[model samples]
Target: MFKRVIWIGGGVVIGVVIAAKAEAYVRANTPKSAREFVLGTDQDHVAERTLSSLWGQFRTIMDSREEELNRRYIDRARSARH
Candidate 1:
């Protein structure tokens, strides 16, 4: 059971990575208008961007939020200790 679970989890990770790489390749090679048509997005600006770009932006926002949350938690902990 444990080995089966590990195999399934590994397969899922590999599949997701392959899919992401394929998507990045398509996003890079496809024309802007074609990509926009496929994505059905009204924004003309994002037509040229790849998943990596969007992921970077998302990661930045998440990191900032995490830092803010950590700061708040530390402050609360210190207050409680006093």
Candidate 2:
């Protein structure tokens, strides 16, 4: 009975210690913000760069003529407002 109690108490303490260590390890390793680790550390103009990077990568799937068509459509839409 006494030995079982000691074992349970020791197990709980060990578990707590392991959790604290793991949390510390993760805090030390992981960045607070994703942008700091991925695109850049700077926060300025992130949305534009993020959109451009994704759109540029997606544009690679289309052929040259398709890309030109897309550009013309986008430009015409912009020009139509003037």
| TM-scores, one per candidate | 0.45, 0.39
Q: Which candidate has the top score in lDDT? A: 1
Superposed Cα deviation of residue 18, candidate 2 (Å): 0.1
Error of 2 at 17 (Å): 0.2
10 residues in a row with least lDDT, candidate 2: 34-43
Candidate 2 structure quality by residue, lDDT tens digits, 1-82: 9999999999989986885675456557777674356436654555577669879987786667798999999999999999
| Clashes, model 2 | 0
User: Across residues 1-82, which tens digit of lDDT does each residue of candidate 1 receive?
Assistant: 9999999999989987896676677679899888667655644444256556878999999999999999999999999999
Task: Give model 1's TM-score versus the native structure.
Answer: 0.45
**In candidate 2, which residue ranges exceed 4 Å CA deviation?**
34-82
